[model samples]
Target: MENKVNRNIPDEILASYDYQPFTSTDIEGMPVERVLPTFKATTGSNKLVDSLADLVNKTVRDGMTISFHHHFREGDYVFNKVMRIIIDNGYQNLTLAPSSLTNVMNDIVVEAIEKGVVTNITSSGMRGTLGDAVSHGALANPVIFRSHGNRARAIETGAIKIDVAFLGVPNADEMGNANGMDGDSAFGSLGYALMDAQYAQTVVLITDTLKPYPNTPASIKQTQVDYVVKVDAVGDPEKIGSGATRFTKDPKELKIAEMVNNVITHSPYFKDGFSFQTGTGGAALAVTRFLRQAMLDNQIKASFALGGITKPTVDLLEEGLIGRLMDVQDFDKGAAESMHKNRNQQEIDASWYADAANKGAMVDKLDVVILSALEIDTKFNVNVMSGSDGVIRGAIGGHQDAATAKLTIISAPLVRGRIATVVRDVTTVVTPGESIDVLVTEVGIAINPLRQDLLAALSNVPGVPVFTIDELQQMAEKKVGTPKPLEFTDRVVALIEYRDGTIMDVIREVKD
Candidate 1:
């Protein structure tokens, strides 16, 4: 637990680094500066492009970075379409940046890398074939993986200037006003894409439903868009919520969910008007279900629910149990459709959602956040980056961003079959232990020693067993036995950056 840098470093030395200012202006309410007139297109000419191929050949150039949002999740067809077009046109040396990469995006991206069409990549996470390829050194350059909030901060500060942003919308106007809340393929909030539209040099709106001029309640305004194109279908609604938004059927997952509920109900912040966030995993989603009944029993109504939007969250909003849904991304079709119909569901960009360097972030108002961990150590440090076998199987996601909440609860099982969830130390530190408040598992709940106030409040909660974090670790070890230590080489494969862009830790490539 040694300090990464000397705490006594002089202020002048710290100022020399590109340290982001903690203070930020309230830009959300302020009107944006007058639109620059240099790139304005004439009204008479057609801004709609005929095909993806022609669009890529014309707008794309060498050494430029392009981005895509993964609102479509597993069923997204737009990424493959755009990438195929780019590859066929002989483009080279382009950087591919996306909010995340699904299994469907792996094949085309791997081909693009081999063909030299894509030379760089930056994203929230990678999986399947593409993940394996990248880990094994498929590309010359190491991929850069960022948390959702950090990516937003990078885009806003010009650290990662985007040349083009190919956004897939379910509905749009002729002038490129778009949103995820309408049409047949509604996927909810376009929070991630909002950043691209605001900052990208060229923003293209690709959609299936074209409405009239000045589309009302546009998530992405027409003023920021440069071109519009209509396609047969932007994505499949059924696939939008696949895999990520499932309710739990397993007993272990349900038990974990129940424990998480116990922790929340006993916490001091579980009163009316409290705001919270949860992940998309089975257990995490179950916590929402359990919380619903608790809310009904207590007659408590939340002020807001934030993060990846799902059907259940939208349902709560519809029932008036939650006042608002502040979405940064949509995880399901129902949430997306709710955006079109519900005025309370607000679409916000990454910076407004959780950029620590921004003037103010929505996460600052969060009372509690329920997070998932791949593994947690006795010190309460979390590792959502590597797997039990030491493979890079997870993403940083919003773990660190939400850890800043007043009460951050990490709910996980003590053991997963033969692999222990609690260890002496984690494989990689994605979230510092100082930010974590409570660790809840099916076997027991462990409140961080730093949070003695929470310990006093929850000490007498019925049906919930509280144990020291060390006791939980011992229980896990007794059940599964200690795992063999991981062997890592000196070469730094990846650097985990905090929301403020400080190096929290580095990941080394596994020794073969």
Candidate 2:
């Protein structure tokens, strides 16, 4: 059946899950009351555990749902180490629930699914071999894909109840008080894990460094933690940021960034005390640099910068161009290290960052946000979850959540290699068109007709040509002729959830 976005959802899958397909309404299945997990009041000064095996054996059982956080990104070690223990114990019908999955987890996740240890899965996205395996119907159940805020909301409302949560931190005390801003393996705010720690029935903290009693400014408090374990290494901080924080040198990317800057600087939101967020990618990161110069020239100072913290964004914060940095997750070691030194760089939980039910998420207050897209349609719908080959390779991350900003700008090249970034219709509509305002490519800028006010505001952005989204789509199709459609089987492999806990779309198994 076709949803409001015109994406087809299998009727059988919808009936089985009792899910409502995506529509224009913001909250399709909005939960009325917030759920608070029952916690045991125990008098324990120290909550230290000896090993991962002991931690898993004590907390895990058959058919239980377990959760984890991916703040470490690709450098994570706790996921594999703990999953191996759970698999060795021969746990069956266990549900794997993580904030998201990175390349480091692909092999162990595949092994567990093959071993029947993990029968169900839910996360932000899948990648590499694991995505391939899921695409071919390797697991017994379809994965439930959630945005970062959606996962937080799900856990809080018992929609995706987590029996056991294994969270890794950079440093922790013997009593389970922890923070991600300290020690050698520091990767930044424990934002995603904060929800897991608070709501999970059994919370486990895995750390590489054991600090003294009362680890100051604990992001993960002792009251929320059930146990703590020390390991050789939790993750590598350097690799977590890697290529994402680098400045772009390519002319196409620079042109896109420049176009985005022109759109922002000329728009109504570029005044003093404006707030913004720069989503990940070379072009998105480069927007911070261009925006910085524009802010300087206009004598503007932003009230705060929100979303994933990065080096370029931190530079602005340090230079006093932005007043506050609401750090939900840090993308680079520089931003992670900055958290230790900068008082203005505040650590926030996922719920506080983007949960729609929270009423006051940072995204709601955002003035401008620069995001990237794998594919976009004339309607301004975005597809960042899948590729032209119909394979899952990207995460929803904060794409849907951050799109709630006053002015949401998508920065991307017209095409990538042979795949057209702008398509007739997105393979998946992760973020609907209403939230997106402008599309800035190297070729030109397109303001959604839905926002005639913005179109009028940005009518004559100097040196930046403007056109209709249809014109951009035609140019893209002109360069690379009409592409063949992707083939998919009847079986649904995953359910893509909107930030409000509604079914945005479904990913069926790719046809062989």
Using TM-score as the measure, the top candidate is 2
Residue 43 miss distance in model 1 (angstroms): 4.8
Could you give candidate 2's per-residue lDDT for residues 21-94 as a string of tens digits?
87763653455576777767879788888888977888899999999999888889899899989988999999
> How does each model score on lDDT?
0.80, 0.88
| Candidate 2 ranges beyond 4 A from true positions | 25-31
What would the TM-scores of all predictions be? 0.90, 0.97
The residue-by-residue lDDT of candidate 1 on 1-512, one tens digit each, is 22342112223323543433222112244222223223555564346777877788888998899999988888898899899898888889998888788888999999998999988888877777787666656665656667888888778766667899999998888777777777887777788888888888899889988888777678898778888988888887778775346788988889889988988988889999999999888888899999999999999999999998788888889988999999888776667666777889888888788887667889889999999998998888888977776666777877788888999999998998898998988887778787899998888799999999999998888867899999999999989886779886655555566666655555566776
Residue 475, candidate 2: Cα error in Å is 0.8
Q: Give each prediction's root-mean-square deviation over alpha carbons.
A: 4.5, 1.5
